[model samples]
Target chain A: MSTSLDDRLLALIDGGDDAEAIQQLQTDPAARQRYLDLVALQIMLHEKLEGDAAVVTPEQEAERLKFRALVWAGALAAMIALAVTAWFALTASDVNHKPVSVSHSIAMISDLSPDARFADATAMMNLGSELMAGPIHLTAGRAQVVFHSGTVVDLTGPCEFEMTGVNQASLKLGRLEAYVPPDAHGFTVQTPAGVKVVDLGTAYVLHVRQDDVSDVRVTEGRVLIQTDQEQRELAADEAARWRISPSGLASLEVTRTTARQVLIDFRGEASQGVNASERYNVFDPVGAWRFTSAFEGTRLFSNLHDVDGKPTGISLTSRMATTMAAGIAGELFVNPVDGFEYNATTDGVFIKGDPDQHHVIFHFDGLEPGGKYAFTFAVGLEANNQVAPKIALGASTQTLAPHDKTRVIAFDDIIADAQGRIDCTVTPASPGVCFITALRISYQALQPTQERMNP
Target chain B: MAGPREPEQFVQHLTAHQTRLRAFIHALMADWHRAEDVLQETNAVLWRKADQFEPGTNFHAWAFAIAHNQVRLARLRSARDRHHFDETLADQLASEAIEQFADLDHRRQALAICFDKLPKKQRELLARRYTANEPVTTIAKSLRRPAGSIRQTLYRIRTALADCIGRSMSREAGQ
Candidate 1:
């Protein structure tokens, strides 16, 4: 299939061998054939490399322009795509001749799904894709909707939301800060008005409200809010709210609220101290005790086996449990000799046998291995540091608020022979509010035949 | 005084000869990306030494000389430690590479008929070499073969390809 001088020269050129040796080979047919042989091999090598070449996207193309040059700076001359180049140039030049079109204003939203229309009706973003919904950066308004996952979206004021891409989103929604991480399957949101803003992987919020314009602000992270027309990004310290009737977004000024105020606003004004309770089977002597709030407390419940002998940790049970407010940063401590920790601010406390601590040295006797144990917790301003839990168990409810004396609750079967451990750690929710206490807990080693039930 | 500033001038100069130079560098390095690196360095040198470029001279040849050095620098900088072709070798290669690409014109004429006759893999391999300008080692790595063996196979294939292209071109020309 080999040919003559000019023909070999042509073949050599096609093989990316634009060298004088090739020209010289053209002078000598034998050398030309060898040159042709060498280049044809190289061409084959190049082809075998691209297993499945993917078409580059615009952003990818721009990035590639930056990195690829440093890689193959002058390896191959690109045969310019004359048609595309000509068309672009022609369009660019002609744009100067026409009058500019009027700009449109609209809100934007986007999500991380291949078919997700958060970006635009036409634009579908895949997982990790980002899309901007509108041209005008939303400076203000209220947008309420439900998100794909369990996320709620409510932007009631001014914000500039920029859509960087499908997965990358930015929100300048002021005052309100809510971020949903891409865990599990997706994320969803429900605004106060029941508007749904659901995202398979992200969450959104509003700094400004639709009617009652509270100066909501975003201090960190971004929230993707749906505007009347598109998706927008609301960034840190930026506030956005919605205006009624015409239903548009407008920028709003902010007054930074205190940490407590921020929490109260999110939770609601009717919030009382937090409280919770649970039930336990004092095994071998199978019986149930009515556990009550021993003191004003922040947290309640126990990591114990359930009715079916399965383990369940911490549950909000009674009105006492519900009314107690354990400001996320309430202080708590445990008493090792007795059993239970008390929250100073709410004066609430709960007791669990040492088995929960996995301590082999200290545990209530007759507590069966793998048996369910229930505990309660409460925290509120009105809680008296009384031994309510002790009283409920037919023991003295003394040592309430204003009295730091320990209440004696004696129970026989005090055998501490267990192998498992429960390390109770308490941490303050805010900087200057609370401190935590620790305890070493253990459980009786289950016999080989004992089967722990699953709840 | 008469020409543009360094970065600007270099950009303009590159834009002018980018295609040809890219093809030449592709042939020399057997990699489009590496060729691109050499092009950038060539532009950088051109920009830095704008004073050395005499006016009304063959800028192409002058730029080519800088490109030649850049190609060598590129080879040295490359992870492959590929053949660091000297200026003379680069010049020889650049010119020859252009000649080889000229065959593409003929191939285009017979492409429709010849494309169908060639094996799909071979045609694709030809496209990767002539169109994408990917590296031999890159291709070999994907193919899971020793680079030396890949090179030998490519050399053989090139011979066959040249024969195929020639026959197709002649047939097309006759028509």
Candidate 2:
């Protein structure tokens, strides 16, 4: 009675005095005025309380309700933030140049409709319809495929192969280099000779030619090669050829071989786990371009540099890159085919490539028309002081720098213009460590896209 | 009863109940977004647990129960840290008045539209005095204003909004 008319009515309803409710309803003028208006609410609340017996005082109910409201609000914001952070973290990991492992087999098919039954000995790649026994199989595409388990393969325009029987596989016509895992049960590439490759616990490449020549090269670890008639264990920086016609194995100097070099660097503190909280400033200090990662699952630092100690004119990508390299603990962060830029502290470099493919690209943009460039790549030597020389893929010889204690390699000078993309590859003489950090490249005139037609 | 009504029957029932339930939740939560979330969660729960409910037996009651629980849960989740709000009980009374009118879905919609059209200052006073459960003294203390001034302001706002609601209803009816 000391309350408002509304409160009193509510109190009556709460108390469950129905007989008194009707009498109280009849006497109060305000209650009579809103009699019909209160009917539905009365029925609903009455049923809600009496039917379920979940009756509660208003204070207690309000306290419980406010708690729920706050929790819902916080949870919603947290979920969105986590999603964004996860996306950027996945991308930053790729920029720092970490290796990726083959968590799933990427199967790609060359011809969606094919007549030939690719033989069991065909080297199946992550790029073709070889039907890999894993989560992701690249079904149809001519891709330089990299698996999460540090396996890189260049599946040509058409081929098929399967990963049958554990690590042992049968290749039809593809080329591949598998960073043999320590746990791998000696993967056998069954050619006509049934060569069993013992796990050297390192990275090696294998290629099958049209004339039945199986070219095997060891990049990092030692590889044991076997034929129906002969067996050989080749160390890193060595290669051997097995001819199907002669049915014999011949050891060859790896210097006579051809391959490409991929140079990448990181610019900031690498992501701790799967996400990054800080944004690193990574940019191609030389050109007008876009930034991209090499592949999915590969981790990279926030910085990358070309052989010419200059910004590659490419920033760290915002996508996960694939991991592919031999014995590399993590995944290699591959740059995208485009460009981007930002600012951050710089980290070291990561070198990764597909073993079978002979072409490594020195990806650069924003170059001058005629600029002098010089660079140095540090080389790590084995016990014998033998330098790991990479095969210069496109143009080989140039002026060498003063060799204080090592080889100062160089490249041919060329004019750069806007008419084409300035991309080249430098092959290493040996395989163990073919990378240089402190490099120099001079800048010259820039040919804009519009100037091409007018000039 | 037989397989708990086909998908088609369920869809039809949902279409019929969705608007009504939405309006009901909107009134209770006073937050459109929260209402929508509760509606979605309620609908999903209703679908999964539809088998437990007998067919043709007070569908609204069953649905309302689910919605009520969802609202309670949502409120608890949002206000876990703040056990009490400093709005007047009169504010709660005003919101309660609207809630009383909320059962009529059409009237509730019309009233909500009119409510939003009111000035922000007036709406705040109304919400504080009527919708929220704070006592007048508590509201005055929180606002750092005199209780008499707040009461006078509230009286003026109520009279104006009553007139606003009446005009808004007539306009909608004419339209």
Tens-place lDDT per residue, model 2, B1-175, is 0113334455456556654565456544544345556666666545544444566676776666556545543443343233121123212323444444434555444456655787888766655544453466888898999987776565444434434555655687799
lDDT string for model 2 (A294-364, tens) is: 32322222334432243444322222222122111111111111111101111112233322332234544
Comparing chain B with the reference, what is the TM-score for each candidate? 0.47, 0.48
Show model 2 residue runs off by greater than 4 Å. A1-157, A192-194, A246-262, A266-455, B1-175
Q: Which model scores highest in TM-score?
A: 2
Query: Relative to the unseen true structure, what is the C-alpha lDDT of residue A77 in candidate 2, on a scale of 0 to 100?
Result: 31
Report the CA-based lDDT of candidate 1 relative to the real structure.
Answer: 0.35
User: CA shift at A254, candidate 1, in angstroms?
Assistant: 60
Query: Candidate 1 has what TM-score?
Result: 0.26
Q: What lDDT score goes with residue A109 in model 2?
A: 29
Q: Which ten residues in a row have the lowest lDDT in candidate 2 chain B?
A: B82-91
Docking quality (DockQ) of candidate 2: 0.02
